[model samples]
Target: MKKKRKSLFWKFLDGVEKVGNRMPHPVTIFAILCVIVAVVSHITALTGTTVTYQGVDPKTFKAGEVTVKAVSLLNPEGIRYIFTSAVTNFTSFAPLGTVLVAMLGVGVAEETGLISTSLRKLVLSTPKTLITIVVVFAGVMSNIASDAGYVVLVPLGAIIFASVGRHPIAGLAAAFAGVSGGFSANLMIGTIDPLLAGISTEAAHLFRSDVSVTATSNLYFMIVSTFVITALGAFVTEKIVEPRLGEYKGSHTEIVEDITSDEKRGLKYALIAMILFIIGMVLLTAPANAILRDPKTGDILGHSPFMNSIVLIIALFFLVPGVAYGIGAETIKSDKDIVNGMSKAMSTMGSYLVLAFVASQFVAYFSYTKLGTIIAVKGADALEAAGLKGITLILMFVLLTAFINLFMGSASAKWAIMAPIFVPMFMQAGFAPEFTQVAYRIGDSTTNIISPLMNYFAVIVAFASKYDEDSGIGTLISTMVPYSIIFLIGWSILLIIWYFAGWPIGPGAQIFL
Candidate 1:
């Protein structure tokens, strides 16, 4: 018998894989993009390409119209910038400090095994009837531990499903969906909150010098999205993916063992530490005269000490509980263990550090050349001319980001490139940078499970292959596609409702300017 021809969708996925394989590393892409921007600056400056636009500054409300002319970065002054500003740009890149600092705390937690044990406990204790939902939700929560969900919950999901007489691959898909597909959604802030918020802040500087995107900017939206993705993942798994997967005849069954007594005591101690921390924060922020609240306005969320020290607060939140867990579990016999955890986390960021170096230079050049501003104004003008506004505009942007996500898998790297352009563009169209960031996140996250270029895709495929010897990229992506589609549609609808109803995306963040 002749082999059946591949479907167009499968062929397209294969083509995407080939193209992604041909693409260079993110660092090289950024470096080349930096060069291209410099050359473009030369060409535009020499050609007298200028854009005249004006708007009220979102922060100061100062309305001004000024002509912006592209500066040639290929000149002597530009070449000096290329060399002299390297360190400054690298150090000043907003996401660098935030991610690094936050990781110290997260590292300690992961190193002490707080995060991984918590995830396993949550998953293993879940009722079998609710296993799919719990597995997916646990995966979403595992974002705090970085890639631990991919390694722990996913395989464990297979084991849990197989033990419960369900299709293991389907279980794997549910977990993968919640981890990667729901990446940007969490009940509380994670490392991504600071990373993406910092990038958004940097981009907002072009339009409003004082407009800062905080880690909590998208908190409320993501809190709701946590449930949204949980339900969506569970639904897709039970209804679509599981049925498609049929019976698990592969005979590889494994039991998911419970967390150890030491781990349970660790969780209890961690919970106690977390409660104490919350109380302390409340004492500091709940009272009108509290230290963390605004002295003048008594605002805790806006332009307050609490808001300013958010990154530190986040780090402390993790550090305290992590140490508590470590002590209870005997994972930390000394300060050295804590230091080791932080070191491990930082070590993993080596690639990120390299990417940031090149990205910072690109951002610096783009800013110096005034290219980002020109592009934003021009793009905004074109958007206005085309009559795209509000939800329509946001949906189009979401689609654009989702498409770009297919090729550029690194969230921060992609945002570092897209933020300067889209954030300012959307700001001109009467949206907040936080709003733009959330929309970008929706697009970024919803397509992650289906993207061949996503950093963890290969690992997920490998996880799938263990259950079914024949499972490959196609098997995994196809399983995940349902989650991607539903999440993209569901999340976008939520955003649309938020837009029309004048809802707050977070404590001090709004959907519109």
Candidate 2:
């Protein structure tokens, strides 16, 4: 018997996984980058490197010529600043507190069993014909609790399909596609929203010191994308992935368990609590002299008390319903349960805290050295020279991010590096920081299902192996390629439409500067 041969495409993908897997941890990578910045800054400063841009004059604070030059972090002043600012950098990093606060509420919801029960009810209640769509949609929505979707919904999808005598791997593919590939598209602003917005704001500081990117910056776009990803995910699963997967042959059986009576009672309590909360918000923001509105401007979304309160509102949004559900379900007999939930959530941040510390230093160094602004000017100049302006420039950036995502997984880590260069570059090319962030997200999300570097990619493979028994990276990637391809193409087309239409991507977030 002759051994089987693999195609060039599979070989290429295999090589990609191997190379990505060999890379150092993201924190170590950032640490290496910090040193590189110090050395590069020294060289650039010695060479008297500078770029003059037509923008606000730094000294005069007027719209005029601005010249920027690299500053060496290895110098005495720079070294002292770095040593002194390390703690400040870590503490003042915007995303750090945003994530920590948001997770507290989400952690309560998860610990109270509200999120899991809600998902189970949603998926189980679907009609037989709509199982695929429901599973995928639930997977998309499950992002509210971070990694819960991968750990819960993906396997539950397999169990659901197996119960219906369908191919379990197909179900797994659909769920994985939605959970990972549709990560950036959610009906609600998730932990990632404020997290990325903070980084974008830091990056935007390169061009304009007063700029602030809000968590709702991409809210409208995210709303549209949720349905887009859901439709695309379901379509690919039924039309392409399911057909390829065929019928299940292995003897695997599992039951689709529905939410219990206690869980049902808890859900109802959560719903009532949520409705009342919304009513309260409307009363606060809908009146002409609303308390949450700007005191003089009568505006809610602009420079108002409401806009600034978004992070707090988000925390309470989950906390309110979460506490209600806990009481109804008898999960939280006292306040200690809530405290425990919050602590558990913070415990998960051990790795993120480390990564954020190093990344904050890296971002600080980049800003202190003026490399970010100089590069932005240079990159924008080059793009202008190449006629890659407007739509073309944005499209090309989406492609570049998508390609880079295959080798690097952590979205925050990648954005922390890319934003310092690209966000300001896009702003210089006449795009808003929010819009640039949106394009980056479209690319980052669509490639996640196929990327071997995605943190949950191995977990997905493990789910698949439970059904197929012989499944590996190739098995999972091949199953997900259709989703990744269609999702990228379809989502890009939607973004193009948004660009040409010039619609506001979110609250106060226009595509152009």
- The TM-scores of all predictions, comma-separated, are 0.63, 0.62
- Score residue 513 of candidate 2 by CA lDDT: 87
lDDT of 1 by residue, 378-453 (tens): 6545544676777898998887778767756667756765676678878998999999999999999998898745
Superposition error at 322 for model 1 (Å): 1.8
lDDT, residue 116, candidate 2: 65
Q: What is the lDDT for 263 in model 2? A: 78
Query: Per-residue CA lDDT of candidate 2, range 1-513, in tens?
Result: 011115464455455544543556556766887999899999999999988765532222233345778898988998998899999988986556656677788789878977667656655676878989888998999876565677557866886777676888888888888898899999988768867887788778888898989989999999999999999999998876776566688988645567778878999999999999999999999999999998998866534787677656777888899999999989999999999988997786675677778877776787788776565455545544665778888887777778767756667756765676677888988899999999999888988888754655645655576676556556777778878889999999999999999999999999998
Off by over 4 Å in 2: 1-10, 56-62, 127-256, 387-513
lDDT for 436 in candidate 1 is: 97
Name the best candidate (by TM-score).
1
**N/CA/C clash count, model 2:** 0
What are the lDDT figures for the candidates, one per model?
A: 0.78, 0.78
